[model samples]
Target: MKKEIKKIVSYSSFLALILMSVLACSSSEDSSSEEADSDDGEEAVTELHAAFAAFNSDAVTAILSDDGTEVYIETTGYPDHTSVYWETDNALYIDEPDVSKTTQDTYIGGGQGEAASFTVDATPDLTGATVATQLNTIGIAVSGASIFNDQEGAGDLDQAAGSLDWAGAHKGPGVYHYHLEPTPITSDDDSLVGILLDGVFIYGRQCNYTGGTPTDLDASGGHTSVTQYTDGVEEYHYHIINEVYAAGNYAYQPAYVLFAGPFQGY
Candidate 1:
């Protein structure tokens, strides 16, 4: 009887040890799971210019650098796609008669562009709509081309349209640029085109014309909405009004101005 009692007590002790071991392992696994969950809860991160590196055109070699407070983009002021502006002797030059500004007696610039850099506030704020001071390079296109505001020389955009390439780009060999949407580098209008001087994004007409009709836009043709890079989080941005409408009625009326009024952001 004494031996049986001792054996039973030893068996109970072994079971208690097994339960403690199992509980300890379970506690350790739960702690590890909690650690992983904490790591995932950090934050959603996006960049101001980091995304532009992907759209680089062959014309410009764009380098991007960001220090927590600011972003600096240094790029060659030319496009990766073929253009009439390229030197006729260069292989990338496309001398098509159908090119927007082609005359047998005349062609646009026949040379490559020099390098230029742009800097702007990393987190620019919209104080109000402000007229662009000059025909500044208001933005940079993914094609590595500069984006001039609504004016060229002293005239409005109408005067400059004649010289643009099919991709809406033109220049004098020194500083090539785009006055309208540069579709050469982007997949479509909704794709991210580039960042403006004030660190705002510029999109083609499709962003506001999702339903084949133009959405109501503010004075600068800008509104806060979700973007591809923003990943569904909303951001303030501008859209180019470059689509021409047919004589017949359409789902959405197109915008006529190139940029439409002034920039709401600085």
Candidate 2:
């Protein structure tokens, strides 16, 4: 009887050990699941904060028009040569210089032209209703080389243009998009130089619209060919002027449309 009781006790001990092992594995799995959930929640919160910060900052401002059309101006280089307006249709319009003037002196050099007068409604219309509404239809364009030209250590303009990061954040959340000289557009030059926009950077030159089929415009200007992007969307982003005036140099005409998001005004 004594031997039999001992054997029974030993079996009970083995059963208890097995149960304890199973419980330990279950606890470990639950802990791992909880940790993953916590990490996902934190990431979501970070993204929300970044978006909200951009919305509330002064980098973007509303310019309500009398005709029920809303206009928002990014004053990065406001009133200066680089000043531009983002309309509801996502079209970016540069203030044309007056045409009466025979010689317009620009930072680069003197060019024969006239400054276009400011009108309520003009060609290349930039008026829009909301930020996201415009962005959804129209894209974005960037003009101006003041920042790129003034940058230090900028190599050849063409090479710099190719390396620009269009989504880089700038002061007041403005993105850099033109004049890729002085540094690669995707590099931290803008941020290091005290020009950051929510940690996002902009493209140096205007990204050409490649949504449609590729087209070739004869050598009237030069070797011109329009290639579409991977998705085959239809929109003209910029013009690549290669071999202009037989100089063998290349220059890009930057233009874009703003479509959507909190960039809209009241």
Candidate 3:
């Protein structure tokens, strides 16, 4: 009986050593991976500003420059896409066939055409407050159109829903903007839509290009995850939830905020 007890104790000790060894190795690897990821994150953030240089449209003119601290942008505030806001005589104007059936938006008319300038943090960091997005032009799409908060103007989004165009945009008396996911620039479910003034990225419906909603998102449509533009580097970003996910139970998960919900920890 004693011999058997001794054997059991020896076996247990052996198992304990193996477990400790495995845990130590795992912790070491995790630390190394985190350090490597930190380096990659820095590089990714630096190159982000350069992505906007790809924007080119006759109706819209945008220029991007980085100052090692922040990104500066200058835009003519025009969109390359078809809009009723464009005067019928202008070459870019196209009376979209479905506009009448959709939003039935009319040209309200008025306001000067002025070039706009903006600056955003080159590396947006979380603070400790939820910023109010209502009635604010939070960001600009790659197409140079303003991106408004989820709310149409100030209150419940229901009242403003009808005014949205078929592709989800309409011109104010002065400016053209989008209140939901803009369609023109989105190539697929996992494409980069735009960058917010706070320096967060906006992506299409799918969290990943391969297909699948992103996991682990916070209240503000954002999460640290791998994105196509970052070349495998994970960064904090927001995704525009497709209509299907925005409804029902899925809203409880990372899919809640349609566009990164009101600048989390602003």
TM-score of every prediction relative to native:
0.65, 0.26, 0.66
Clashes of 2: 55
TM-score of 3: 0.66
For all candidates in order, the CA lDDT equals: 0.61, 0.26, 0.61
Native-structure RMSD, model 1: 11.7
Count: clashes, candidate 1: 3
Q: Candidate 2, residues 1-266: lDDT per residue as tens digits? A: 99999999999999999999989988988998898876533221111211112221322332433443222323233211222222223333333322111112231111311111111111112123322211110212222221322121333333322222232111112323333222322221111111111111122222334222224422211112232221443321222222211212222223121111222211
Which scores higher on TM-score, 1 or 2?
A: 1
| Candidate 1 stretches greater than 4 Å from native | 1-50, 57-67, 98-112, 186-188, 208-214, 242-261
lDDT: the better of candidates 1 and 2:
1
Tell me how candidate 1 scores on lDDT.
Answer: 0.61
Q: Which of the two candidates, 2 or 3, achieves a greater lDDT against the reference?
A: 3
What shift in Å separates residue 55 of candidate 2 from its native position after superposition? 4.2
> For model 1, which pairs clash?
58-80, 59-80, 213-252
lDDT of 1 by residue, 99-194 (tens): 555333332343443466776556555764576535756677777777776677777665555566756666743467766556575433576677
